[model samples]
Target: MEPCSSPPLLSLGTATTSLSPHPKPIPTPTNTRLAAYYWFLVPGDVFNDYASLADEINEWWWFYDGVLINTSPMGGTLIARGYINGNIPHTGFPLVNLYAHFTY
Candidate 1:
């Protein structure tokens, strides 16, 4: 299946963002300049029953091994390309990919 097929919820792909020693706010469609363009899956249903996995990731998206990364207007894109496979674990409560696009 294509990345964009499963709504905006998909495994978060690897991205290039700065990791700071502090906790940063979550990026949205506005305000923050981060952009999660691509959403991918983890091939087969490796963790189909690991729906709760996304919650953990969402809670610590800006954290790398416990350290928080500053994800504000740092340029480039903020792609959450790791939680795609387990996004559709539950129905209705689908996770939508937050893609922030800027035009200035």
Candidate 2:
């Protein structure tokens, strides 16, 4: 399936502004971003029927800006890449990735 086929299930947004005398907050779109993805859990027996059999198995996805851009490979490693507001320098607002092992 294509990454853009689905929307994100969870989203979070943050903002930054200058607090000064006669301060007029600068609304920066560069500080904003979006992401989404889909997830499913199939039975271990069904997965084993396809190919190899393991004690644990699972599948999931990660989305960036309403598009699926990252994935969790079987074996417990996750990787994702995407772009954030390039206009904002040194801001790590666009990076997303995580890894964890399944416990039976």
Candidate 3:
């Protein structure tokens, strides 16, 4: 991914929809320690096989900070949950300035 001048902004206004019912929150794992492996939800219909998906991910390897794997749960599903390192993007500065400096 290209270097961003600012952190991405999350807009909640359009996130929730009145047309459809809200989705139940996914249960958070109890042990949230840092890990090397990351998970991603790949749609079943999108790829013909796992190799194809792996190839696509490999093609755009630069965009990801770490590697992606199917783990135990992936298995060609419409919605697969994955995990990633907490340190993606190398966590630098906050998007917004917490305090402003005034010139005298």
Residue 29 error for model 1, in Å? 30
* Candidate 2 ranges beyond 4 A from true positions: 1-22, 30-97
- Candidate 2 lDDT over residue span 1-104, tens digit each: 65685667874545476546787777878744334321112221111112111111222222222222223445544432222323323245423333343433
lDDT agreement with native, every candidate: 0.38, 0.32, 0.35
Cα lDDT tens digits for candidate 3, 4-78: 688559746765656558777899999865433233323331222222334434433433433333322333222
Q: What tens digits encode model 1's per-residue C-alpha lDDT throughout 17-97? A: 756799787776655534222233234323322333344345444433433322342452443333333444533332432
lDDT score for candidate 3 against the true structure:
0.35
Candidate 3 ranges beyond 4 A from true positions: 1-51, 74-104
Sort by lDDT, top down from the best: 1, 3, 2
Q: Model 1 reaches what TM-score against the true structure?
A: 0.18
lDDT of 3 at 1: 85
